[model samples]
Target: MTDWWLWMYVAAMAGGVALFTRWRADPRGVPLSEYRVAIAIPFWSGLWYLVMALGGGRAEVAGHTVYWARYADWVVTAPLLLVALMLTGTHSLPGRRWRLMTALVGANVVMILSGLVADLTTDGTARYTLYAIGVLALLVVYGLVWGPLRAHARRQPAGIAAVYTEAALLLSVLWAGYPVFWILGPSGVGLLGSTTTSVLLVGLSILSKVGWSIVDLGRLRALSDRGHLTVV
Candidate 1:
């Protein structure tokens, strides 16, 4: 990735920040947990994107064309994304502690980082082993989302429940595609060429990160309008 191709990633990341900037706070000063988490989601994500945008995309690891900058971006932003999901439920599921949210966030980070490690591993056996571990972690992630999280959302108001359910679904589907991007790249399965991988990964990142942020923003605004969200 060089020149315009490389700059494309920068543009995508920077544009993501721009999209989320509009919602960094409740313009109306409503004090909702969703507003807080919603604001934070993009701020950290945009920060990581900026970091990745500045850093090196290529690394000399296993000749896999490692984009460690992307890994760095995920390591930090992934947890914030999970926490954003939990915040959607703050008012609906008020009695819960952060244990579940924290655990889920940790699991999510482990899942992606492990996959990155696997992709970077030169040894085939070790790579597959790490990949399996990452897959297991993702299963656990979905189990939590569809299990307790889904249950709680169901008990929320109809609007909140709808938003949470759709948000969870969007998040789960998009996040799951990361490994596929890994596989398509020169890194993992080598199903695609380097340029192709970069393009697809860029598109995927935009949809997952920017798309995820937008879904939550619309949801939060809806809650605010319905008087379900609290005032900040």
Candidate 2:
């Protein structure tokens, strides 16, 4: 009923619709793996939005009660999905590498669980541990999967290069933005801290995805110019 709750619901519905549209469109013309990962974007985004909306319905914090689920979804779940999409989307990656992809997804699952645990735990230490695990999982994803994919993208066609570059930039933004927001934002008791952190993270995550879409569009334009593909 509150403004924060209203924002959360709206964000969730919007994200869900966007993701569904993306899935239905399937514009990439890539493998199933890529589609699988891509489909997750909206679902997770919506879920986080819903969670925050419900959890902080009438809660107040630091002069406001902005829904923070958007941040959490963006920072934690969205990144995991993005990384998965990138890895699977890479032209150079072999099918056998899917095992690694699966592992990465599993790590993301853990991160999601960690977040939930943090939310549920009353003890400060336990919550922090869960948060730490979520952070570490993301780090591993960057170090192991995203790192190699970036290198491969650099060597691929300009279109691929553009996509990967955009992805990299998005990841970098997410990596940098989250901690800064958390450290500087208002601190309060109960759901406020985690929710706020989540909202900030989600904003960054959306920014990164938008960046990728822009880069991909540019790459398409370049490719069209080269006469490799006809402009639609």
Candidate 3:
């Protein structure tokens, strides 16, 4: 397949990085930590997509070309995205929040790594087994977001609570589709070709990364303008 999709993803990610960075310049009452992760998601995605477009970070796995760079990007960006969502909910919470954030990050990392190994495996049994593990880890992630994280958001003021709710729900919904794409794409049953998979994956990535962040940060900005957000 042609690499034009990869190049297009690179441009999309680059635009995301620029847009988020510009939003970060006047963060108002929002914390720099939020902006830091927001900027990072697209920054890393763009960088890795650039590498993939230039014909780097690919390898033959199970007789199919695997873009390992894509996994590398996910392993980093996924956790950052999760953390950004966490920070939105827990930023104003009292006491040590790092423990929960750490747990979420760890589970997310396991999920990404499991998927990577599954992609690399040539054996059907091993591949599906790893995919199952990844799915388990993913369930844990959703549990935390919809469970404790949602509770935390509810404790916030109405506006902040609304922002967190929207962000978390949007992210969780987008994430639920990744496993389906994985199962159908080259890494699994090959029900979808690499070209179609790449298109869908890129669409998902843009929505989860750039689109989600804009919805999130924009709401936070509105809250800040209204003097409702903490000076975090």
Candidate 4:
């Protein structure tokens, strides 16, 4: 695999770990646990898209791979990871986590349908436009729904909401940039810009994971000490 593919794999694994850690720490039990699993869906899907984009090469699929087309899917799919992360954290949809999940599923379905149509129709401009629409849909969902929910949740202590919200917002910004780059730039420039943006996002993801891990460790230590003191 290319260096880009390797980096993508690393980013996915790191994000998965960060997400799992937060899920485990969630004291609310099943509501949050289910949310965690929901969050994993997009992370895993995005990872698959990343691998296909970077490593699938010119392999034929149904007579034509549409290599660049698959990358457009990757761009659309990547934002879902942030959305999932936002939902899993304290920023759950007020009385509507399931509703948000449904919306996410619907958004993904539209994206897939549009992608297939674009692929079969072999309309490059339409494909790009459809992918751009998908990206916009995700942004609106995150900003209007998930972001507000998270902001409300952050009123509590433990800093979980704040950390996760910051991470998700950072990721959302990165994901949103890809389509903007494609829409505004010259040929080949989008690829360069997208790849550069991915690199930065991946780097920030690693740091975010590290921070979360550290915080989790501190909490674990405090709990352990509390238990020991009680025994003493």
When sorted by TM-score, best at the front, the candidate numbers are 3, 1, 2, 4
For candidate 1, write residues 1-232 as lDDT tens digits: 5345555655665665665555554443334454455455445555554554566455777764677777777776777777777666454565764778877988888888897888778898998889888888889989988888778778877777788888899988988787777766676778887768777777777777667867876776767777776542
Over 4 Å off, model 3: none
Rank by lDDT (best first) = 3, 1, 2, 4
How many pairs of residues collide in each model? 4, 5, 0, 0
Candidate 2's displacement at residue 132, Å, is: 2.4
TM-score of 2: 0.61
Model with the higher lDDT, candidate 2 or 3: 3
lDDT for predicted candidate 1 compared with the true structure: 0.70
Candidate 3 or 1, higher lDDT? 3
Q: Go through the candidates in order and give each one's C-alpha lDDT.
A: 0.70, 0.53, 0.89, 0.47
What are the runs in model 4 whose C-alpha is more than 4 Å off?
Answer: 1-96, 108-121, 146-148, 151-155, 181-232
Tens-place lDDT digits, model 4, residues 63-178: 44334434443444433453445343543323445555566556655554554454454456776777666666665656644555565556534444554555556555544554
| Regions more than 4 Å wrong, model 2 | 1-40, 47-80, 87-89, 92-96, 179-202, 208-232
RMSD of each: 2.7, 5.8, 1.2, 7.4
Q: What tens digits encode model 3's per-residue C-alpha lDDT throughout 1-232?
A: 4488888888988898888788788888888888999999999999998998899988998778888898999999999998889888976777657777888999999999999999899999999999999999999999988888889888888888889989998998999889999999999889999889988998899999999999998899898899888864
Candidate with best lDDT: 3
Residues 1-232, candidate 2: write the lDDT tens digits. 3346446544654664465456446444443444444446655666665665565423443354444454466555554555644652465544445555566667656655665555455566776677778778767766654566566666666665665666566665555554455434432234445555555655565555433443443344345456533211
- Ranking 2 against 4 by lDDT, winner: 2
